[model samples]
Target: MSWMSVDIGENRWLSVSYYCLRQGVSSGFRMRNWELQGCNDGLSWQMLCKHERDLSFGEQAHGVAGWAVENATAYRHFRILQTGKNSDAVHTGVLACAGIELYGALTLACCGRCAALVEIDGRALGSAAMLEGARAGEGVRGCSRALRRSGGGTRAAAEKALEAKGRREQREREVR
Candidate 1:
């Protein structure tokens, strides 16, 4: 049995709703029992979820080996512990994972009425500032049909918000 973990950095908390695991290209062994753990300080861990299915290479190759997290807990660190493998005696307990993907939404303010700006995959379809401007009784052109219909206020706030968001994303990318 073996275990592997990854740190998702600090300050930002992730609301992980689902996870995807892919088998390594050179490995034919499949994980039998696995547990996913989450932590805040990376010292104390909580069991997020566990699975005891056959994660065979053939099944994972078709992208059918993902599971939804029951509660969608927000955590800063995650660990994957493998306890068993579906292989012969010579290849027992060998763990080989090619890739793992976490899918979830980032906690962000949506101005109470701009839920439409967020897509089904937890991605914001538009800038937060534009949504906030629309909520603040300002007209944001081309942002949404509803906003365009209720046209009136100046575009100053929306523009400022978009600029700030752009700068923030740029800084975050640089940090990464």
Candidate 2:
């Protein structure tokens, strides 16, 4: 029903924990689950984790925990989702909340002498320098690397760019 920032770190990973309880034994559990969402700005949050019950056991604690998405855009806020509540419910009880925490670090890659950039395409697109120095010509909209072919191709040196499409087309024409 409510959300708050629990903690922070200079790093990129985030961890958060919280506790809740029913108004009374007969009133029943007012909240059934918890969720973790993320956002670039503090405005919109995409659901990272969802619909989880209390992680603790036999402790009679309504505490659910979730982790922030790795490499998620910096989050300025967090939220809680609540369900299963009614006004006349005799089983209702006030839930006490406490001990919330969050932590994270920057996401990066270092492999030997070569480093990979996160959120950038072509790093894992097969051979290095294959798609290097390639560019899409003007008026050309965009190229989808998802359809890129790799290995044993005639255009092996071609990077996944709009320009590569032009080169591949020219090669096909020459072959004909």
Candidate 3:
């Protein structure tokens, strides 16, 4: 009846994991039967994984479920549909645990362009030329290396800015 949907940004994930609320015999509200579905348009859904009614997490502490989408087709939209509830929760809806962690490698890659220029390891790296010089998919690490390539002057400036910002924060804290 109820479902939790996810938009995998502009990239696709090789696999996904779901973390539930609780587990064990007392898990009346815990999701028992569910289906992991995928769709590119969000209108038509295709089944990815089907979990039948069972208390499989006998010793699994975290109530975690995961699977790799072996179809190899890149889907942008994904949903975990609760098909059936526990006998104790027969009158209720929703079958699987909701997503707590969203893992996407591309999300980090997408932000590398701007995040690198912002700061890294408490140092401020304000360099437009460095970012422009770097290629896509290099991510934060590549952008950082680009900053280093820009020479010691830029790196030194970033260090000073970080130090200055720290001093400013300490001063504000004392005032407060």
Best by lDDT: 1
Better of 1 and 3 by lDDT: 1
Considering lDDT, where higher is better, how would the candidates rank from best to worst? 1, 3, 2
* Full-model lDDT for every candidate: 0.58, 0.37, 0.50
TM-score for each prediction?
0.55, 0.34, 0.47
Q: Residue by residue across 1-176, what tens digits does model 3's lDDT show?
A: 87878785553332333323334334455656777777878899888668777565544434654444445444568777778774354546734353434332121122244333544455445434333333232212334322321222334544554556567779999999
lDDT of 1: 0.58
Scanning candidate 1 in windows of ten residues, the lowest lDDT window is 144-153
Candidate 2 structure quality by residue, lDDT tens digits, 13-127: 2322322222223224433355556554557766655654543322344434334344434444555543333222453323334444444422212223322211223433322
Error of 1 at 106 (Å): 2.4
Best by TM-score: 1
What local lDDT score does residue 76 receive in model 1, on the 0 to 100 scale? 74
Better of 1 and 2 by lDDT: 1
Model 3, position 173, has a per-residue lDDT of: 100
For model 2, what is the C-alpha lDDT against the true structure?
A: 0.37
Please give the distance, in angstroms, between residue 24's alpha carbon in candidate 2 and its true position after superposition: 13
